[model samples]
Target: MDKNELIQKYFEKSLSPEEAAMFENLLADKEFADEVAFQKKIKKVITHEERATLKDKLRTFENQKTSTDKWWYAAASVFVLLGTAIWFMGQKPDYDTLYASYYETYPNVIAPVVRNNNDTITDTEKAFAYYEKQDYNKALEIFQTIIRTSPQEEYAQFYSAISYMELAKFSEASKILSGTNWSKKYADDAIWYLALLELKTDNPDASRKFLLEASKTSRYQKESLELLKKLD
Candidate 1:
């Protein structure tokens, strides 16, 4: 059978055992595979168009009817379309879109240490201002300086990791997030950022795993569950 016939039979779901076998064999060919995929997409478009047309006709009929009775038809159409839209969303959730929807910049809360009794602002203070203003390049430089001076400061470490993320250095960000010396105070934030970094790095399995583990803790449980629902 030709590709068109096989596609039609497949859509109709009435292919005989022998014909179905032949159709499967044809799908192995790139041209045939492309045709089938194109046909499926076109079918989806046509189905939506036809549904909209039917809805318009129903609306027109409802307009012609008495005002009290017309509401039933309108309500029915709304419910049907709503159900279809929800089904479509479930059938094709874009992971990248979902990630963006859930992701937000981590807020900075730590103030720079006082260098002296005078009113002089230090490099760490400048870095905090830059970070607050979203000046990531300057923040990264100042953060590096602070890390050098006080390598044990967990707040500086976490913010420096976020600076790396803002500068698109995800591997560096992951390294800081995976650091053992960070106190438990930053543990939840670290896990969340690690999950986000994994997603950015195109490692969905690792991202899912991180999210699952983080979900056990209350801090990110709600968000992790929502993201996991989309992933599943």
Candidate 2:
């Protein structure tokens, strides 16, 4: 088959075993891989544009004159919800797929790395710089040291859990995140990541429970709701 045919089948996810092998080989070519990445970005842009257009039309419809419009607006809202449910129903992904979809590394918000001429950065700041650079092993080492010295440092503990998660040390991450006495600032993050960890570990029931709790208060409220729909 031609490369175009392989790419089309890939996007449709209908590749036969032989076509799948061909697709994998094609990905080894830089030009083919760039084409795939470009297609992905184009698809994302189109999806966002379509969603924005739908929302704009819905807003316009709701702003139409009179109490009579309320009934139509209500019907339209129900139709949108049912359509979303049907879409999710057809896209029931496995736990690993769902985890990959939702898991992003937690950012280094606690300490923004500031460059200076002198070598005067603190351990916490240095650790966060490593974390931002995706050097999880070194970051975990420093964070563990900080926790040992000041056990009450919740921010250090929080980032340590993140580092563990990055290293796929799920048990260690779970232990720290599930511990009591997280500060209010990191409590919601811990809950949300615990949900992702459970999903990664293939415990969907536990993941659902944590996601439900996170939906109540985390910054991931919309994501939690959407993931719950997928689980359903």
Candidate 3:
């Protein structure tokens, strides 16, 4: 059979065994292989061009101002959706990108207990100073020591988790956040950060749960809902 006919049969997966074997033999020729590849690419380009042209026609029909314009709009919307699906199919899984999109340093709300001299500076002050300087390792050290003495120091506990998160120690961060009471001032923040950390750690199910919990809080409802939509 001719190359075109054989190619058509190949695409339809309807070639007889003999024809299929012959096609493969023909494709062994470098020139024949190049032709087949060129034909396949052209088909793709033509299909995409046809979609674009049809979409333009649909848009023009929608602009004609008629009772049927709603149908035209709906038709055009299908092409838009198909385009989006195509784009999504071509996209790489990007956990890091998603994490960066939502991850930020949790804000400092700890009141400084000392200001006058270094000798009087509380561990909280030293830790927070390190935290502000983005020396999260040093901050984590101080925060851990302080939380030992002030077990109910919610801010210390919370920021220590933030330090762990900054160090990419997601399990440690999640543990600290999970152990703390949710009614504390950082509850909403903990839920949100934990959700994001879950995403970073490749735990989508847990991430979704945390996002759902965060969504319940009025402060994070809209944002968490948006993130949940992206996950789905």
Best by TM-score: 3
lDDT of 1 by residue, 1-232 (tens): 5555566678779999999999989889997888677556545755676578777878786878798878887778778877876787668457667767877888766663444567888776788889989999899888888889988766778888988988888888988888646567988888888888887777766776677667768899888766755554
Quick one: best lDDT, which candidate?
A: 2
The predictions' CA RMSDs to the true structure, in order, are 13.0, 16.2, 16.5
TM-score for each of the candidates: 0.59, 0.59, 0.64
Q: List the residue pairs that clash in candidate 2.
A: none
Candidate 1 Cα misplacement greater than 4 A, ranges: 1-93, 112-117
What local distance difference test score does each model get?
0.77, 0.81, 0.79
Give the poorly placed runs of model 2, Cα more than 4 Å off: 1-92, 113-118
What tens digits encode model 3's per-residue C-alpha lDDT throughout 1-232?
6675686678668999999999999988997787678546545654676578677867776777577567867676778878986798577557788889888898777744445554677777788889989999999999999888888777788899999999989889989988878565778899999899989988776776687678768998777776765664
Ranking by lDDT: 2, 3, 1
Candidate with more favorable, higher lDDT: 1 or 2: 2
Q: Candidate 1: global Cα-lDDT?
A: 0.77
Clashes of 1: 0
Residue-wise lDDT of candidate 2 within 1-232, one digit each (tens)?
A: 7665576568779999988988998899998898777556545655676577677766767788467777777577769866985786687469888888999998777775444567798888889889989999999999989989988878889998989999999999999999757878888989999999999998876786687678777488888877765675
